[model samples]
Target: MSFTLHKKEKLKSKKLIEQLFAEGKSVSNYPVKLIYLKTVHDDGSKIKTGVTASKRNFKSAVNRNRIKRLMRECYRLNKPLIFNNIVGDYAFMFLYLGKDMPTYEHLEATFKLLFKKLIIKENHEKLN
Candidate 1:
């Protein structure tokens, strides 16, 4: 498992992200909320993900963009754990719920923790 950051792993479509938000089940664990839906594709070889920071919290576009960029970077670095652990494909939307912007260390730790929780959820489901 080479943790290569690839273009296909990025979730870029607004419509798809919104659809996932509308149809997906969410899990919240303070400061971060995850909205995920199982997706089917003939080429189900990779996972795609998106991140958002609420305007209601940061009113400034600069702040929101900065938060989103940080979240993406954190996810990019941490997501290979999920890719290696899960057996199948999934589409994930992560929303930042904190009132203040987090430092890189905080974001990275939270991202890894969330991914680990997700892997545990996936494993638990498989055992059922």
Candidate 2:
């Protein structure tokens, strides 16, 4: 599968977003927190994702945009790692939580770790 994230895979449901924050399970790795919920779809395909930079942490819009860009890039590159471990549909929101700006290298490494954690997380959820 291609590493490109399509428009269809971008999470944009306001209702789902609210539900996500209310009912999702979260796992964090320092500068990033991933909150995800398994969603049922007729096709049982596709993982929709969103990214956010808290206004509380990054006051400037530029800073927030930059952090979101980095988050998306890292997520796009490593998503295949997650796709291998997941089945059906899931909606994910990646929240940036760092006090200061983080480098692309640091974000990339952390994203990799997050992917691994997500796989383990899903496996555990399946067992419970």
Candidate 3:
């Protein structure tokens, strides 16, 4: 798969987002949390992902947007971890859980760790 995150790969449907929150499971690595659900999409994409920064933590929209941008970039770079190993389509929401602003390096590390944990969790679930 390509490193680029195309428009179709983005999680945009309001209905899907609600269902994800209601039925999804989560894997968290410190300031980053991945909320995911196994579901098929009509678009045929293997993963549909979204990133969010809490407004309660970051009051300014600028800071929130910056954090989200960093999260998206980190996920875009590290997403192959999920795509290559997982067998089915899933929806993911990456949530920023810390109160402080994070640097790219920190977020990147967190993203890698979080995805690794997610893979392990998924595999373990499959075995049961």
Return the top candidate by TM-score: 3
Clashes of each: 0, 0, 0
**For residues 32-111, what per-residue lDDT tens digits would candidate 1 score against the true structure?**
88888788644544678778899999999999999888888888777778877887667888899999988888888888
Model 1 TM-score, 2 decimals = 0.86
Return whichever of 1 and 3 wins on TM-score. 3
Q: lDDT at 126 for candidate 3?
A: 100
List runs of model 1 lying over 4 Å from the truth: 1-5, 42-45
CA RMSD per model (angstroms)? 2.0, 1.4, 0.6
| Candidate 3 lDDT by residue in tens digits, 1-128 | 78999999999999999999999999999999899999998988999999999989999999999999999999898888888889998999999999999999999999989988998999999999
Model 2 clash pairs are: none
Model 2, position 126: C-alpha lDDT score: 84
Off by over 4 Å in 3: none
TM-score of 2: 0.94
lDDT scores in order = 0.81, 0.90, 0.94
RMSD, model 1, all Cα superposed? 2.0
Top lDDT prediction, candidate number: 3
Clashes of 2: 0
Which residue pairs collide in model 1, if any?
Answer: none
Please give the distance, in angstroms, between residue 88's alpha carbon in candidate 1 and its true position after superposition.
Answer: 1.0
